[model samples]
Target chain A: MTTTARPIRRRSAFMRNAFPYFMLAPAVIFLLGITLYPGIYALYRSTMTGKFKLEFVGLQNYRELIVDSTFWESLYNTLLVGSLTLAIEFVIAMTMAALVYRDPWVKAWRIVFLLPMLLMPSAVSYIWKLLFNDGRIISDLLGKLGSTLGNIDFMSSTSLARMVLVITDVWQWTPFLFIIFVAGLQGMDKEVEEAARLDGATWPKIFFNISLPLLRPVIAIALVLRGVDILTMFTPVHVITQGSPAGHTETVSYFIYRTAFKSFEQGYASAASVLVLIATIILSQTLVRRFFRSGTEA
Target chain B: MNAIRKLTLSLWAIICALPIIWFASIALRPHNEIIAPQPIYFPTFTTETWAKIFAEWPIMNYFKNSLLAVSGSVFICLLLGIPAAYALARYKFKGREDIGFYILSTKMMAPAAVAIPMFVLFGHFHLLDTVWALMLAYAAMNMSIVVWIIRSYMMEIPHEIEDAARTDGASDLRILWSIIIPMCMPGIITAAVIAAIFAMNEYLFTLIIASQHAYPLSVALANFSGGSDGIIYNAIALVAFMAFFPVLLLVILIQNHLSRGLTMGAVKG
Candidate 1:
């Protein structure tokens, strides 16, 4: 009886251990079917170059991508817009987070603040496109602010168009960073901050030293997530600028999109897509690593 | 110092609210007034734009399509995400952490990166220009978020409750249905709401996959900007307002869950 029970017990343990994979099967299979398979297929398609008839060109598409000035320009634009937006968003969100962390009334106003983030991106882009019109509210407001802005087309000028894209992004996304920062601030150990204050640490010192370090994980996560998103920003550019004025506002994602759909260069677009995937992976891995390290330390 | 801070915050709030307020005003104004050079910060009210949106545009069809896509995506997320979240939360398994990271890493890949491939795949399967394609794409896009959010919530529930249920001869599914799910209702709801909002707002994949047949409000509103009548600002505003209103209301109602949801529980309020 004891010998028979022992085998049964071992078999039951095996079944119990296998239960998790059973539970995980559906999600894994679904994601594999949808995301992973398609991604791998894209990578495979990137090597071949042809519209209708396929020809395997070893590294040819990638070589062309390297020499492609337009691709490089879009890449540069993506980075510039992404970094500028991040810097502005971080500063504003951090300041606002600091201001609102303790005030009950202000904390309650988070919902209002988050309104922009909540709206559909396309809708936000559409609304901003209208506002950026030559004689619209935004232009009039700028004129009122003592600038020689006489019917300036915001989207036609390359510099102004880029600035407008950054501003619109900052407007829509700062609230998200603000919410995260506020949450990070609230989640901090009050004792450490109060102790620092009692120890004659100035507010700025406490912020720079204690609060910032403590909030590193949240900030890092926000930066990476927002960075990835900003890099892929499409709707605003597509709707407002359409990558016009000599394609100055064209982002990497938008360029890839136009290449794939508009120009129908599936092979080259796939090559670009593979490069994007690689960049995303490298950046996400580094950022997520930093986030995890800080998270564990905190 | 406190007073100065308060003043600054109030000023910032006004700045933040300005565009939205302007948007609402534009949406309500007469078309001629919208194009008037003298910026109408506050407009005399009119509903002609809204009236035209309903009567002339296929706004309702857009709304219905948006509803179907969002609901289908959310349903898929919940159906698949819940079990995976449960396993991650409860059971210790080989490659558990790796699997979790893999799921999250999938999100880092932008939808555009896979757009061409997905387009081809859907086209091959004759799924293009269908809401089902949009639903499936969105479901794939949002599944990671659902798992992450719901798993975080499930982790917060004590394991002893499940242990007790197991001792009482309840199967894992039974405990999940009877005990675990009931306890994690708020988390599930938050996950579902976030997924729905994402699906509703999804533009790129929808734009690529479904042109006219499955065009949601996002595509419709985008198309309005390039309409033949040449940029009726008020009508565009009205359509934008209509497209945004439902999600805005939902966000306000569930504002508590939203902050945490948006961050995927990275920062808890």
Candidate 2:
């Protein structure tokens, strides 16, 4: 019995060493096929030019991208829209979360607030598109209020069109931040806040001194996740504005899509996509490191 | 202070509910009333648009297609994710943390960065315009969150049970099947549900890969507008409502797990 057990133990030891890799292999291979391989292929394609025929061009696409006004405009539009939407979402979501985080009775609001996010983004964009249509809900409401503003097309003006994009994004995503912040608040240790309160701290004071600092990691995670998403900013532009008014409303994602599919400029679009990808990696990597570092320290 | 809190919550709730209410109101209005010269604030609510959309469009077919694609994607994600998650959670191998971060960083990539090449690859494989393409794309897109969430759940399980099983001469795989899987069933279900939501809501990939045969509800809804006459607001609204209703219900059901799932378990709800 002892001799038999010894061989089995040896075999099992070999198995234990091999097991984790065996379990991870299928997933890793699949992920590589879908993400890494495609990403690398895209990088390769960005340097070559052709329409149904391929010829290598060294950095020509990137060089042209430098002088492309449309590319620059799309980048500018993406930054403008993305920053505005993030700023509004952060303020609204943080305020709302702070207001209701302590209330046990407002649990239903959580589900209600989550409704906007559940809708397919395409559907959400369409809903807003209809509401903002000529003589539609928003326009009609404005007309009823005796404002001449309702008579003009919201999509025809650059500012109004960009505003529509911002409004749509804010409406859909603020709930995401709100829910995360509420969870962060609830999961925090309450003793610090209670101690501060007993030390004659006001609610606002306790919140500022005790709660906010502890919540830094959570805030960082939420903002970075949401910021990464808003950086892409595609569907509303596609469904509602279609980057109209001389392309003032075109975000980077939409610009890439239009270039790749609409004009069939595959190599050129790939270059723009690579630029966006690099920027995102740099931006998110910094924030993610900061978040994890704070998380470990706390 | 309490009054202000209550007031704030109530106001936000109304603000939250208003757009949906407006959508429903438009959905139930008659087409004539919708297109009337003056905005019909109090048109008699009718199911005519809903009925018309159902009768004309193969709504159920798109519904079935969406269900098939999303469920197929979630199944593949779980099949791949669970073992990887368990390995990362329980094993102390070299570079395990790096491997986990590698998996996560894939999610940070913009879909645009990969879409053209993938489209070309699918064209080569003749996988374009098929449910298979959508399923594969969704699985890839959702892999990171699914793996991390499941890993977090696995980490919560006491390691002593597996240790005891090991001493009893049970193989690791067998122990995982019989012990860990049942114990982490809630986490598995949460991951599946979240993956399904993202898969179902996916539009850009579906739009690129699927044109006719594999059109999910998202792409189908997008194509519903701009008929012969003009934009059909009521029909569009009805289809949009149907597109969202399933995910909306699923989200409400899984409200407690969302924050963790959304943040990939970085911050537990």
Candidate 3:
């Protein structure tokens, strides 16, 4: 009887150990099959040449990517667009967040503020495309401003086209950052802030030294998430610019789309994709870790 | 200070609403007014544009496709994500942290990184140009978000209730179904709503993996811009309005949960 009871106990313990894996199985299997497998397959295909007859080119695609002027330009454009969007979005979001944090009426207005972010990216692009039309209100206003400088076609000129892309991105994403910062502000310890005020600390001093430090983790999370998104921006460029004016407005993701679809250079596109994947992984991992660590210490 | 705050807030609100208001105005204006040399700030209202959009384009077909794809993908995400979320929330499992991080890392991988290979794979499986391919791709893309959001909510549920149920001889699946699910229903709904929105908005994968047969509103609206006649402002505006309205309704309905939903429980107020 004692031996039998011991064996049954051991069996129950084993089942308990196995239960979590059973629960986790479906998600893990689906992710691995759909996402990870395709990524690995893309890496493998990147080293090959030719589409139906397929021969292993062994890094030839990468070699071309190294000296590819178009690729370089697209990369530069991606960084430029990404950084500008990040900067503009951050400043506006922070200012708006500071103004409206804990204000009841403004709090009620958040729903309206989030409309652009909530709309489909494709839809956002379409809206902006119309606004950027030569005779549209936005273009008319900018045109008036441009007469002082020079002629301006928002979608045709290289610099203005890029600026339009950045503006559209900022309009859509600022509310995302604003909402996060507002939440961060609401979550702060009011006692500490009040104490600082009682101790004669000025508003700027308290904000720069206290509130900002406490909000670092939230800020970090927002930056990394939005950065990844801005880097992969495709819809606006695809809809509004289509890399017009000699590919000046082409983002890296749009460049990949053109290569694979228009040019039918699947191998070269795959090579570029692998490079993108590496860069994204490295950037996210490093930034998240670095910010999270500093946030905790602060 | 109060006056300044009100002015600033009002100004920002106008900036925020300007594009959407402008787009809607174009959709309502007559065709001639849309193409005039001067900008039409206010034009006579007409439904001609909307009538033309519905009459000429397969707008209903695209809407149906989008609805089916978004609902299908959200259902799949919940089906797979709930159990995994429950496991991470309740159970003490080895490799739990690693698994959570892995799921999140999948979200960081840009869709373009795998779009070419997915196109090739779909070609082999004959899944290209079908709603099934879009549904599957979106389900995989959104599964992590479902897990993260639901898991955070599930963690807030008291453990003793589950323990009490177990002591009454309830199985793990039985407890999850009978006890845990009803309590966590709100979280599940939030996750589903957010996932649905994301799936509806997806463009890159849909553009690459689907042709006309499974084209969603996003793709259809995009193609409208590139049509042979080229860039009719009113037509594009009508299509854009139609595309944005459903999402606008959803966001307003769930405004209270919008920030929490978007952040995936990261920055809760």
Ranking by TM-score: 2, 1, 3
Candidate 1 docks at the CAPRI level of: medium
Off by over 4 Å in 3: A1-11, A134-136, A143-151, A287-298, B226-228
The digit string of per-residue lDDT tens for model 2 on A1-298 reads 5655623233566777888888888888888887668768878889999878988998999999999999999989999999999999999998988887887854777887777887788878877887787337788888788988745688889999999999999988999999899999999888877888888899998878778888988998898889888888888998899998889999998999999999999999999878877786677566655664211111
lDDT of 1: 0.82
lDDT of 3 by residue, A37-132 (tens): 877988999999896889999999999999999999999999999999999999998888877875887657777677788767887887777677
Q: What value does the lDDT take at residue B247 in candidate 3?
A: 75
Q: Candidate 2, DockQ to 2 decimals? A: 0.57
Q: Could you tell me the fnat of model 1? A: 0.59
For model 2, the TM-score of its B chain against the native B chain is: 0.95
Which candidate achieves the best DockQ against the true structure?
2
Model 2, stretches more than 4 Å misplaced?
A1-14, A292-298
Provide per-model DockQ scores: 0.52, 0.57, 0.51
Chain B structural similarity as TM-score, candidate 1: 0.93
Indicate which candidate wins on TM-score. Answer: 2
Question: Order the candidates by DockQ, highest first — what do you get?
Answer: 2, 1, 3
Worst 10 contiguous positions by lDDT, candidate 3 chain A: A289-298
| Number of the top lDDT candidate | 2
Please write out the lDDT profile of model 1 over residues B11-121, one tens digit for every residue.
878877777887778778877676665766667888856777678778788778888988999999999999998888887778887787777777787788889988998
- Candidate 3 vs. true structure, TM-score: 0.93
